[model samples]
Target chain A: MSDHKFTRRIFLSGAVVTVTALSLTGCTEPKTQLVKIEQAGAFFNPDDLTLLNDIAEIMIPRTGTPGAADAQVAAVIDAMMMTWANGATRDLFSNTLQKIELMAETLKGKPYSSLTLKQRQSLISEIDVRAFSDEVPDYAEGYKRLKDLIFRVFYSSEAANADYVPIPGQYRGNLTLDEYESLTEAYSYGG
Target chain B: MADEFDVIVVGSGVTGGWAAKEFCEKGFKTLVLERGRHLDHPDPEYTDMLAPWEAENAGLMPESFEDAGRYSMLRKKGRLYKSQWARFFVDDKEYPYSFPKDRPFMWTRGYQLGGRSITWGRQSYRWSAKDFEANAKDGNGVPWPIGYDDLAPWYDYVEAFAGISGAKDDVETLPNGDFLKPWEMSCAEQFVSDNLKKNRPDRPMVIGRCANLSEVRPIHTELGRGPCQARNMCKQGCSFGAYFCSLSSTLPAAERTGNLTIVTDAIVTSVLYDDKKGRATGVSVVDRKTKCLRKYKAKVVFLCASALGSVQVMLNSRSDARPKGIANSSGLLGCYIMDHFGGAGATGVVPGFEDRYSFGRRPTGIYMPSFRHEKADDVDFVRGYGYQGGGSTRPRTSHTGKKVGIGAAVKEHVGKALPWRMRLIMYGEMLPYIDNRASLHPVKTDDWGMPLLHIDAYGRDNEKKMLVQAAKDAEDILIAGGCINVKSSHVNPENHIELGSRTHEMGGACMGSDPKNSVLNKWCQAHDVPNLFVTDGASMSSCSTQNPSLTYMALTARATDHAAKLLKEGVL
Candidate 1:
């Protein structure tokens, strides 16, 4: 109940901000503009953000469900980078992504954007296999982290198309199968 | 305002909070002084308000040796990670102490109005008659002046007030409390409990007796506290006031009395001893920020600045009446230190509970009471040990090898529940030795300019023996409880000598009948100075096999009541 109220307020205030911004500008000069979802973190640099967004779009392409890029997963991850990563972690994450991008280009035998859809998917799947292995190869460790982060961000984003309720009253110690199935479950591992 | 009050409670943690509440409610103008920052009933510093994804640290502190080397013991435990709530943990560089070279003591200090109470494992258990009698029977440490009978009433009082969550067990070792409501055991845990009951009746496994209120009573509602939401993010400071931390419970109650005055950032240096009156007048406090000195007078004083922290105060105070320090007549002030002997146990899979799992975190575990010399087949060790562990089913996520599955197979495996595993950690009693003591550091000084505590403590032969016995017994118990793939035992050379890492440090100003051997009396008061008290972990004469905070709260309440009565009777 309260979750809906808070989200509604957020949407209202967001709309107000957009209106105020548009009114203040008054002139449409659509040139040399850089777009960003969250400008708070180390990953907010446009180059890194664009690369992460492209990687996410390839991983979770729009089918029936909203894609990773559609949910702004990269922007969220970028914001989280500031809170989560120290210098060492930040370097590890960025360096690993760069290595993966190079590997993917080499595997496809072409630049990322110019590659066929099948070739791009094939490269992702190949990386996914190495990433999901029992003991991740030292080379695959960065891609593994990147893949895990993608899934984590995607599930927690608006793309999941799930409802939320704050203060989930009195946790049930024992829930029958029927009761669980009967209820409209909106599961989240807390944003 | 007035610098004088009827009672002055130093170190507003568990005991200090209780002291304030008890004294204030009794119509005594009580001043509760906290050395750290102020915190109110509704915690503003809680990480529970932040979602896990929102907090990139996942409401935990990541392992960072660079954060402060002092948290070396805790940093590995992902639960203690850096986030909004890690602020509760003191930065070790600012407040450093020295321990023995061989023995690495991990002293985690929670420096806030609530102190370590905010971060403590809420496991609340009453020490049984066996626990109280062990020291006296074994002839290791000084005999407890008061026993379970003396403390039974106070335990009931604190349990009711604190709103303990536990089931009534007719068992002798683990006595039941006046619990509001008991948290239910998981299917796997229940299986283990039932199996233990049927096969090994001597080993009773029950739901952990904890201070988190399973159900709220009107009294708790009056104190602006509610029931445990079972979110299990309590270490972040319970935003709901569900757990009985000093901030959520006692301090708030003290505030409600309108007779309580709380002064935060007041680092108490020493007790101001009076020569003529043979009493403690008040305390000398330095401003935590400005480093300015100030004095406050009270008819009675309670020292609840933790175990070693209180000892620093006693050793710092210098007076003509008792030259060594206030009430240090015997020169036995910083002696006979004790902590729960840990670092030995067992872990294994209870294969039968494969079909069972639990929902929502219990935030507590099963407690196996001490076997010691109680049974017919007794161990060679003097004191006993108890196993505090839990049996839970979690998704099978441990996979590490050169060859492994990928894609859908790995995803499916990572998302499913693994077999139930029973992990147990044995806590044996550490026998007190006079050599294992904490005194003032010779030259080193903290930010407050007070002498840093030099804790020279080590595990002895008896503790090593206890660990060995505990390991063997834990293995036996696990196998008997129908466990498979058992790692026979978990005793190690490094953990055996873990000095103060358990953070259950007790003694120094221990309570005893004889003033020659101990610092405090039966009422937890200074043997020489009646008006002064040390009701925190410092007053523990013997280290029992359970968590000691519940005992500390009871002792604080009992001492304040006694002091109030004595003050009314016109006694010094």
Candidate 2:
């Protein structure tokens, strides 16, 4: 009240006119949730979200660039395991996606999204080149945790927001990478 | 008009924005206060224009939700948890404090309105007469009655209005200012600064002086601020006020000297001390959104509230003529509590620049300064250790658990730049421990019931043998500079040491000629309340190794110009 000039639209219109002028003077207190609902809770299972969105579209399929299922990265890994996985990282990412559907029904049979995209990219390159930390195995740590959570949601989407330069309007710092790609514009090489 | 008048300034930060811009440009009538909430500088709660794939937890923040698990202790601090600079830091569960679980300090706070000078690490440097003659030449606790030619003209008047950016190089252990044009360094930091100066010619390096404008003057384009477009996105605040914060340079020059005011959720919580006008006759605050209590008055108060938050407002200011708090009649207000022993160092890989890269994002790094200082103590430690870090022709965070590889060649190898690599880190100099103190928690109390402080502080045994000889002398200067697969930090003796992970906190009301062992004197005033001053990082008499907010803005502009020339000689 001592004029700090903030804005979340003047704080939800001054908290909805102070809770509608304290409920039109019927004054009942205990109200406060000033907005923050978002909880629907699901963290996979519609057949492990259709085998983790068909193994995140064969590790980012669409080629002319926009991959990881064109960036809907399994709905940001189901909203980061329903608001950021906690219970021991949602039980170690649900026992590594149920050991990648029991290692695709004991080595490529019925489910890991019913194989064949060249045998699911050669069993995701042999369960992602094995040995993925915390001492491996859980279908080699769920193909290295769903391939590092679909490369951290396709390197932060909007189809990897054209490798930022943010407010990099200018700042030379001694060029020459062909004078920094002929002065500016040429960075997007990934991540 | 604001209950307080000729000078109040409890803590808007960076020593209450240089004592409310030198007490409102010498005409006084200032106020300031701010225990969080107002944040204006490019404020839309600045996420330095987001884009690192704008949020949905991209810039980081997923330690399992609930507002990022209420900032899991600032996600163990490193680069202050960046999911949009963790919503401008501070909130140890509604500002609680306490310490000592086998010595674990981590008291990092940020509390808005430019506090924590909007998440610091603006690394400024300067402090030199061998860091004010190393605490009276290593007896080690109280000395600094002002040195480096009494702060080289207040660090050339706050680096000519806070611009800095480096490359001066006079370097007698970092002492050169009024800079501006610098930020270059990365042909793999000029080949590890010419192979660590052909092997340690007293450890040279340079570059990172910082604060950032990299050329701006016209008094910073008449103070609207610009330059620093390096866009390393300064903990998401700078919006081209290109660095030097406290709402981009001294509370907008004390809001263009119309004799400042500020307030914002107030909260000072102590310093009134009247007892027959012995002096400090103001401040009691509270509101932080209606926890109520008020007070104000003033003739001069200051206490830039940090470094154990102005000794937790002079230990919750109880009275009875200094009952262990207020001017603290040298019960040395909260003993000596300090900070900077930093998480040690290392990292490697610098082979060849691969055709010289790095064109911008140079938000600084490449300092080195300490070189085991104090006329080369040569170990058994007393004070030294600098080496900040640099060289990254790329490959640092390919994000989450070192991503192996997948899709379009891992999105063109995580937007490229993985060849050179470097790092350094170190920090050191912690000494000050009179049982590394900071008191208060007689029983905890917080969320505005106040009293939680308690912090104990640690890092002794001369800061664990200077963080294991500054991490094996930063892996022997990254394998003597051509760096290979180096690596360091993991210094043991059974590890531990997380105390305030380098938020660079400082002493607890220190300064002393001898107000019976100190609680502000060598002009940080209040030998026992003469108008009660306290230039922040609370009067730091010792914790030296540079970067202590450019000596708390040259000791709050040389103690608010000696309390505005003793308030025009009426003697404060």
Could you list the CA RMSD of all candidates, in the order they appear?
5.9, 23.4
Candidate 1 reaches a DockQ of 0.16
TM-score to native of every candidate shown: 0.86, 0.34
What does candidate 2's lDDT look like per residue over A53-163, in tens digits? 556656666676666555656555655664445677667766776776677777787665545566766676566656454557645654565577667767666665654
Clashing pairs in 1: A135-B401, A191-B53, B60-B81, B61-B81, B61-B82, B62-B81
lDDT (tens digit, per residue) of candidate 2 on B366-430: 88888776544557767877878787345533643245445555545545556677788877778
Lowest lDDT 10-residue stretch of candidate 1 chain A: A1-10
Error of 1 at B314 (Å): 1.4
Q: Native-vs-model 1 lDDT?
A: 0.73
> Which pairs of residues collide in model 2?
A60-A68, A189-B415, A190-B414, A190-B415, A191-B414, A191-B415, B106-B500
Error of 2 at B239 (Å): 14
